[model samples]
Target: MQFYPKGREQRLSIHHPSVRPRRLAVLRAAGVNLLLLQFLFLGLFCYIFGSLFQQSTHIHQVNVLFVDYDGGAIGEAVRDAYKKLEGPGFPTIIERSASDYPQPGSIEGAVCDINYWGALYTTANASNALTAAFAGGSAASNYNKNDVLTMVWNEARYPTVVDSALETTLKTLSQSARVVYSKVNGKQALQNLDTSDSTTMAIFYDPWTLASTNLQPTSQGSRLIYNTLVIILIMIQEFFYLGTVNGLYVQFKLYTSVRPHRMAIVRFIISAVYTLAGSLCTAGAIWAFRSGWQVNGNQFALSWAVLWLFAHLNFLVLDVFTVWLPPPYVPMALITWIITNITSILLPFELSPGFYKVGFALPAHAVFQVLIDIWSGGCNPQLYYALPVLFVYEILGAVLSSVGVYRRAHYASIKAESDEKACEERVAAAVLQQQEVQLVRQETLRDAEDSRSSNEEQETRDARPRRGTVTTIKDQEELVDIIRREMSRPTVESPEDRRSTTGPSFSLPFTE
Candidate 1:
């Protein structure tokens, strides 16, 4: 009936007819192994992110909308010049009709919207501008304002690469045209036999010039914006992972009774703070390395706030995801990895097909733009764009967290009440069954007592002597003949009413 287990194995493996054996099932049954799962998840992200920048290039073939409103000789010459200067990596020049290019009036819109990198428009009087420049000072006096070439661009787009390419190409094209014109004009003067014209011909051919201006940053290219973005992202992710230590510590404390939203909030706070501190320290280190770390008040504040938002959003999302996802660490790390790659932090976004929506949706790309704006142009309209994406994570995630808490807590309370009520019902049923059993025992005892009393009364009746007319049978044989006849004859069928009389006429009743 009883067995005492002497060892752990026997206790753990206890098996009986009434009991099922307990065995350790797989780890996933109880949810993921947190330590292994988290390390592996983070390690995967580190490896992927660390290697991403090396494989990608900022330079890609840009699509330029080339518009020539000027059908003049200079415009035609410029087109011919562009023809000879073509290759794989060069901007693919697509000549657009005035109707085809729904060009934004400004260059900022072009690159900010990322529809096109740049637009080239030559003015209507380019040839006249060139001819006026060829004329002497008295003849060219009124043409001072007549600019030939017009170049406009989104200053924020590939600050170093795009601008450098455009600048270098324009200068080379202009200088080449100037040299050609000088040669042609020199030959024309020699053939015309005009010595005075030869002296004036030294005023180089058709003063070629490109007038460039930016729609956004009036100036450009003091730093590598993408490099800085990548560095910050690397540091941010590093600090983000570091904060997981604090997150786990806080979460362990919170495991007892923290609300889901509160947990998410706390996690975000810890990460954002850690990110800010680490970023500042990293900035200090960067400053130390290259003390030209321009301590622009606006730049530092905006960068800090933007980076903090990204870090905060990262933790908030992970906190929320941990609620339903079985392997908690994987979703966080996997999503972070995806966001990093799709942010187009390494390569130009246009290079990746269908990257616009995905890239912009990612927090990384937004933060990068915010960083660029801060680093170069104080605070700009780009900050307005970046903040909303973070706001979505904040507003939507907080709402979800609150709902998650409310629903789970509500259901838990309901389950507890149901369980309590079920226990009370079971107890009440047992008590009722016991009370019924007690009543049944009392009824059974009473019935048995009544039956015993009836049996005893019958026994008493049997023991007692007959009360009437039995002495006549005790006298003589003839007198007893009545008893014998009564015994021999048939008895009456009813005791209540006598239907028939048998042999003895004399009344002789025998009782025993």
Candidate 2:
């Protein structure tokens, strides 16, 4: 059986004629709010999705350094082939003189340093090696065609973008270069080579191919989490902990007992400690499933420290919003934060619209870049800018969070005082009303007694002075004095009274 009132048992449909005005008004307000929220989130999320809008069109913007050391038919063919694909909608291949990068190692260092998206280098002896193979010299039998040209890139910098756009473009350019070489030198090389030998014929068929050297190679899979998914998980963990803390405040009357300033400090400390532990776990998991990555203990520790800083910054940033924004809007703020940062780190900002360049200052992008640098054995030099940006965000979060704590405390104090004053006023009014009722009852009893006394006096008609209006006036004055004395005295509130007055520690922006 239902233990509620009869009114609760009565159910009404949405279009019921007997629905009350209050409920109907509430429903209409909720419906309007849902519609408005839909519009707001739709626009916000779409803007986030647009971060990758027509990104392929920007592929040509990537700068690739091309230095052909071999100034022979093969090198010239590759250079001309790359120049052909340079007009629009392709990677820009910038040709540098062979003398400029005298050592091949220097070119690889440039790519690792992120000076260019990728680099193509033809060995100084590429044409000489092929010519030797065709001449059937003693060293021609040991000629390695793979050493003719080299393509150097750091795939770990941004695997997805590199694999999809830059790497693909470079591979296509290499194919075009091969075709160009065949057309220019195929007939001449066939005439010069000894066709009687099977090995020589094989060399004539496939003269040269681009040899790839990934300066910073990434894992095949799973390690991708540290760059992308782990960041979101850290953010989610922070929100989950915050929700639990809010629940504790609700279940217990901690707001009434504890000072707001102290509460804020404790909150920050707990959140920091929580984030630190979570970051450690995250770092440990990464180390466990590292998939044979060649990272040293020192590098792992440094990366873990960076991850902790990143997570703490996220907590602080979210804390600022939680204490200021309304509960309903907090989720929206969360989604916006996650989406904005996630977009920045997913791809290089250079390949996106100019507007997305702001990713340089975002927390996720900075941390991701730093982590990639560390994991790739310090390939990219991004720590200088990334570290400072994170520190700035930390300072901002700290200052704003402190201010919010002070303001919330001030609001709580004011509300507590107002509630106490209201309670006192209500008590005073009730006491005055009760005193008046007793005064009237006394008057009625005195009137009945006087009437009886007057009948007795009529029988005796002697020396008895009758009690009159003066006596009644004295009693009324005495009662007024007592009430005045009680009203003048200050009332002390019990602990229960204060608890009843105090509200939740964290209030929404729209609510108290």
Candidate 3:
């Protein structure tokens, strides 16, 4: 036997249709519609294009071999300068064999072919043919070659002028020293073999060396930070997208009378699943095709932490939006987009001028920066500091969403109660009005019958003798008495009244 009443069962079957079967059907339909393929294509495009764009723009340290052919004092000085440039923070320097000289695909220039900004080259010769070659010159005709040639030639010419100036200055100093020595000692003693010593000359570089003057080093950290920031920003957008979708679904279900807390829980689960899946897909695609994106186990752990925090932050924000702004998904979506874009996730925060620093303090900004730092082998002291900020945002979002859900649910309950009370009041008023009308009709009918009986008795009295008229009056009085007795009898209640009294007896009645 069916457990529920027929009407109730029908209503339940109509309103709470089998969601699992419907969901399965929808999934199958979506699969057949090829929407999944579109999503996959979009995801792949984002991953691949984003990775390539990041790699092209972001500068990083790369391994390079620097062969020094110039063993002379100047060459040795330049080589020593280059060697001093090697540090733990910069690119790794590798030594190459003599055979490795003039090697093809050598990263021995100022800029790598791959745009890594790291290069390796030999510097043993004072006139570096490789430098000239890098400067875009033919090895055959070395004169008047390239821009680098002109620069280096000009640099060499300046040193010659400097040497000449130094010679003049030293001659004056030696002459002064000699004059002092002559004044201190005898001129004859100073004149013995001092001519040879006086003829001796030496030159030294000025306070600023050529190596210091020519070299302008860029920071590896800056490029890494910027590129990583862009990638993380994109990831933040993805997180927000997924979170908003899940939140909207949850909010729609709740609007249909599903439990808000349960819906929230389900939304969180779906969000986590989507986040994990997307992250894995991104990581896998990058690993398979783009090997340059480096991540150690520790760094990976940090990245995951960053991703998790970002996901939760997005989820909370979207949940709050969903609760506060239901029905029109477009407005919420536009608002979210505006907020995200303004947070400096889509563009460089520094480019935002006065508000950049403040924008960077937002949850999306903090999370993106943290992810960039983790991915690109950099560190942000502010990331640790910003954790509390993100936590606060999350807390506020959760509290506000909870409050909104509670208020909405309470309003729905109150509305339902009000509607039920109004329904009962309408029914009761209709029943009472019907009963009054029936009583009025009965009273009118009884009066009409009494009038008709009196008329008939008068007619009979007129048709008989004068004595017969008195008897007719007695009969009429008796008829009137009988009618009064019938009218005095208690009336039975209507079926509707009995039902109204019994229907809600077991339930608490609502007062309008």
Candidate 4:
């Protein structure tokens, strides 16, 4: 027999028994859902990826200070050279007065404090030293070319941006300064120098040199993982831990026995404890392979505490999402969260578009700055700002997560009550159906008995019964036996009853 009726439209082939209308309807719905999800993620995930697009075009926002303390020809030549090279796709060179940084150490402080991506300074009395050396005295033999200019920067602030962008640009500028100094001043200075003094002549020939000072060198390669891979690892750990906790709640039916508020407290405490332990391990791992870093108790404690806060905040945010979103959509939120946070810390926000200033308020950027501060031996003094951001995230996450938990619990309770009422209604309907079946069986038996008695009465009245008079007693007896066998066997209700009796609905285990 044909499974589908004739003339009915069929999208799927008729060769398989499973290719039916109801199953096709389910497949169509699932296909639509999948298509919609693909478009949805395409829009959202692409936006996340676009955060880093064309980042090089915005490099001008990164500032490097240039100060000319030596009011001599050498300083003037270098400044003019930089001015000629100034354009887009390079760091902005902001020239400041030498008096703004009188002490040599002041430039170092400015670079280390992130006031500038780097600094270039012409040393004080550099022109005097050069002119004296040109006079062919012992000063010429002792003249140090490196004393002419100094370049200061902190590499540990952002290793990639410094090594690839800022450091390269500064070195190029330094080379240009040297070349400009020679072309503009070399001919004039040579005309005045004593040619007989060969040592003085050689010093004059190679007069311009750049003294490079990297305040905080990030030599350790492992630390690179902190802002990128390690953050992702922590997120994975939190996700699995949350899954385990939810599994336990469902496995033990804790939602029924535990109060929602109490459960929220328990989750918070446990998450804090777990994050502390994980943070210790993470910090210890760094210390174990520190590779010449100056590790100390204070740094370790600070890093551990910051990591714990960061991880716990992640957990709370995921908690809020998982509680409020459908299960199928939670992974999407997870992807969005990871990419956004990672993007915020991946590059120096200074080099990003103005729209990306939101990174300043994100937790990963703050945590990364703190870590850099700790590792660089307090080079980054932004902790006052960074720490407060983390604390604010912590406070907001805690409050929102707690409320989400309570709301989830309230919804679960209401759903459970409704399910219980539905179950009761189903049970009552089953009982009524059974009673109706029994009543129908009793009426069938009574009709059979009356038929038998009527046939017996007809036989007594005529002393003989016609063959076609009515249904025979044997037939009545057979009908009665069939009814008895059917009623004795199990009662089978209609299709609606079977559907309704499938099972009790269980609450989702996402939260309390």
Q: Pick the candidate with the highest TM-score.
A: 2
The lDDT for every candidate, in the order shown, is 0.53, 0.78, 0.44, 0.77
Q: Between candidates 1 and 4, which one is better according to lDDT?
A: 4
**Candidate 4: tens digits of C-alpha lDDT, residues 159-249:** 8667767877777777787688778877777777988998787777677667888886666878677678988888888888987877676
TM-score of every prediction relative to native? 0.51, 0.81, 0.38, 0.77
Evaluate residue 69 in candidate 3 and report its C-alpha lDDT on the 0 to 100 scale: 47
Cα lDDT of model 2 by residue, 270-373, tens digit: 87898889889998988888777767899879888988888888888897888898777888789889878888887787678888888898999999888888
lDDT of 1 by residue, 348-368 (tens): 554444433466666666766
What TM-score number comes out for model 4?
A: 0.77
Winner on lDDT between 2 and 4 is 2
lDDT of 3 by residue, 1-512 (tens): 65645435533342355665666665676564455445545654553344334321221123334444443333333344435444432334454554655532343222222122123332434334322322222332342212110001111111222222222322232233233433443333333322232221100001111221111122223333333443454446554665566556444535447776765566556656776665555444433443343456676666655656665655666666656654444333434443443345543422223333555556766665565455544523345656777788767866776566666667767776776677556555555565566556545645565556777856644554444445545555565556546544546678877865734321111111
Sliding window of 10 residues with minimal summed lDDT for model 4? 463-472
Candidates in descending TM-score order = 2, 4, 1, 3
lDDT of 1: 0.53
Q: Stretches of candidate 4 above 4 Å error?
A: 1-37, 44-49, 131-137, 192-205, 422-512
Model 4, residue 17: displacement in angstroms? 8.6
How well does candidate 3 score on lDDT at residue 316?
A: 63
Cα misplacement distance, residue 334 of candidate 4 (Å): 1.1
